[model samples]
Target: MTAPLRPLVRIEGDTLVVPGLVSAHSHAFQRALRGTTQRAAQTGTFWSWRDAMYRLADTLTPETIADISRRAFEELRASGVTAVGEFHYVHHQADGTPYADRTALADAVIGAALDAGLRITLLRTAYARAGAGRGPEGTQRRFSDGSVDDVLRDLDTLRTRWKHHPRVRIGVAPHSVRAVPASWITALHADAKAHAMPLHMHVAEVQGEVDACLAEHQRRPVELLAELGVLDARFVAVHATVLASHEARMLGEARAFVCVCPTTERDLGDGLPDLTALRDAGARLCTGVDSHVLSDPIEEARALEMHERLRLRRRVTFTPDRGRTPAEQLLVDASVHGALACGWDVVNGDRETSWRPSTRINLRARSLADVSRDDALDGLFYSGSAACVSGVDDAAE
Candidate 1:
């Protein structure tokens, strides 16, 4: 006789369980500056806020960086983020000399993730310089390398050395258009293709950056990348807030992913992007904690939802009842594309067996179920925060 079908939850003494969380884009080093940077007197546009960032960036030693990253990774894991993409750029010494091992800083971060029991992708950044023929100015020196070739070679070496490791993966990022040249973008794209690695860049984050790219390249940042043939599915354009209609459409057509850091954007006062419009245009959207100013995925997800609400002046942005809720969409963005963006494997159904027990999510909580899976996921996106995350499961290990 066939046995009775068992319910999904196990009653082991009477405790509830849940799944793991994932973080798409994180500048681990920025965790250190959270409280200290807020007191600065200047008006806090992305550019003005960056001055504070530069100060924090200047003080990090590999040891300190590793410590902060480990702590940040732990906090993320506690919040249910099982994997993280560390968008790292602080490479080399203050004097701009390579570490003896060259991959020293990246190694520290990877080690921190391992210690924290979280999966990690090191998106090592290639920052050539601030502008044309201008070497890195002030605190930016630590983040720059001499040539794009050197940067690629360093990444190649790091990958070769760490490719066999289980939890650590490597990807490439060209700091931003303003920091690197068009020729470098082309070459970096080729390198990304050759290595079969993911490519991420900060695009259209600030007016100054957009203006500078337009002045020098005669095209907006997104348009310039498109013209250079660098815009594609493999690319993750962080903060594509300053896009025009055409650029937004182009992102959708290219099958590119846009990572929106709503909390950080709001914190820094950078403008918000039209997420629903972008989704309708066929662009895949994801969320990022970005600056770690508020390392809560729930809040970040909410920001995405609220932006839509404010843009349209309506309530209930993500509803799974009428359709998928904003929360559900944002969760998928944080979990599914988040994993893909960071090169982590997405665990589905039986595939989840390969992942850590804590990484397996169970959406049986009232907040999750209050809106049916069929209801719009807007509530989670529009209203949820980190306080709502009870805890992840440590089941079936």
Candidate 2:
């Protein structure tokens, strides 16, 4: 045979580089909860784990949140995430009172992202507590607003204040079906639409939330959202773990997006998302490292492909008639589309606003010259780990 291959950097015009990745649904604070929360099996289910999370939440000052977010964002960038969507809900002080500046916590998070050089979309959350129509639970006290109106007002203030900022975009999030009343979701949906902002929510994440919704509203969470006219193109339903077959169809029909956090779901025993079904039904798919348990975009993209592989017992689960390779299709669906889920541009060399940094995969200059772009991308998605990611930064776009 011939001699072995050589690695060289391939350049058609500028350089061979994939678009930077994004974490579409990050809870910056949850980076602290990974190993500590997972190792303790004594606490079961999302509810029990909430207690541990509550203690963690109670300990954060705005400064501490900023520090932790900077560190976390650094790790994310190093692992190839150039942008983040922070689903931030911890707004007020521990006693449910607004901080002196009101936007203190949100500002802290945005500052942290800018410090770490990652683009951020702050999805400020609306938390209207559930119970006997009373105040927030003792642990959740820091996360609530008196009403959806209060939450909307805070978001408006944030938008007005940060509209001119380059790296920060704002969105609205209603925490979940269990945490907020439907009235809040409806109003927030209206606010999101009027402002042309994306709406993010945790829908059907837990069985209990579904059961409670059915008991109270006579419909599942997705069904309730659909009934209330809250499901639409700008709406992103996170977890979506408990989507009914019909609800999945409806979600697709409505052109809504679904964010799957596979690592977090697996850690929490939250069950695998029906990715193939969701795709076939026409709903676009993206991923989130919800708890920051793992921040690898490759892993997230591969997890989607592999999960579908196991479910359907076939390779190339995401491949269609488009003639694109499985890996290319998955990368675009999982990474590029995921970035756009929170309104981030990829900024690759092909676009008019393409980011042209000196960064290169060096396929030809490294030990992979013979690796075709297709094979290189496949290896990147299927075989490469976070360790293979070389650099991340903002230069010019």
Candidate 3:
């Protein structure tokens, strides 16, 4: 029989100490759009909301992105996210021109994360055309690259520059099926495998993108990825809101991770994913604070179960097949699974992985006023908010 998961959660004094939370996917610059995009017309749908986000993306400079990212990261740290996967795509200038240094914006973002005291995985995104047979339009130009080679070269550059940094890891992200050609996905996967790096991609975030993929590739998004032979342990399919049951099984068979950004997905009116399908298929689950719609890692992780309960009209969804309890599973999804998705687990040789940070909840917090020690984790994850988190307890680390 397999041993149970260790270091589940420890209660010391009036605090509940757990592994530092992980936000496996983030778009830090979108923190600026939080209040503005909630209006009636701006949030009519995911596509309409994209219009406002695109406008905000165009207005950013290295200076502004740094400021925005710093604010986002600081809040994330305070809320118990010690590591983040910044799915950074804004590479060039407004008119699709590369900066003089080429890595200027990414540098700024990495610097900002460090400043906020968080380990960051810059998932440098690759955007090619706007869609099938179309060139990038408007703000997408800022995110697009000329060729697959360019993106790979940028990865090499980033790897070399940040090779020695203990807290920084670099991964490649193909923006989405609608943003990159199928050929690029194959090349990107090859490059990532050659380098032993993680690969992230936006998959099935919206029905329109899936429809477009079906129209062009004659296959669904995940099916195309499967045919391209990119599914692996290092592959992270983000915002997989509309995947088929078979696709979930495919990801499970490969031991791949599906990162659900519940706060951002619900905020943008995108549908929730099939959690039951993913879990039953054996796919690893993780969470992301995507779009900065909300910055609660606890909420993000709790939503995995809470959302499932609401969807299936059940109380608790996950069974302890190998004796990993539902709350323990949620903690895994919040912390280690997130770190694994960011290439933080096995990618960093001899370095600490997901266990690097530990956060504690204030037992005195109103959220846990009457909670027993055994149920503190459940209270922290479900009823408690980030407000209940006092801070990261570095001494516990």
Worst 10 residues of 3 by lDDT: 345-354
Ordered from best to worst lDDT, the candidate numbers read 3, 2, 1
Question: What would the per-residue lDDT of candidate 1 be over residues 1-397, giving only the tens digit for each residue?
Answer: 5334222222222222223456778998888777775766773567777887888788889899999999988888777677788899999888777888888998999999989877788898888787766879987788888788888888888899888887778888898999989888899889888877788999898788889887888899989999999888778999888888888888889878898888888888888787766776667777887788888876766677678789889976544322443454566666666667766554542122123433332244455555544332343445444544555543322
TM-score of each: 0.86, 0.90, 0.95
lDDT, candidate 3, equals 0.88
In order, the Cα lDDT scores of the candidates are: 0.74, 0.77, 0.88
Cand. 2 Cα-lDDT: 0.77
**Cα lDDT over the full model 1:** 0.74
- Model 1: how far is 250 from its true place, Å? 0.7
Better of 1 and 2 by lDDT: 2
Backbone clash count for every predicted candidate, in the order shown: 32, 5, 0
Model 2 TM-score, 2 decimals: 0.90
Per-residue accuracy of model 2 over 344-393 as CA lDDT, tens digit each: 54444112122222223444434344566647876667777566666654
Clashes of 3: 0
**lDDT score, residue 68, model 3?**
97
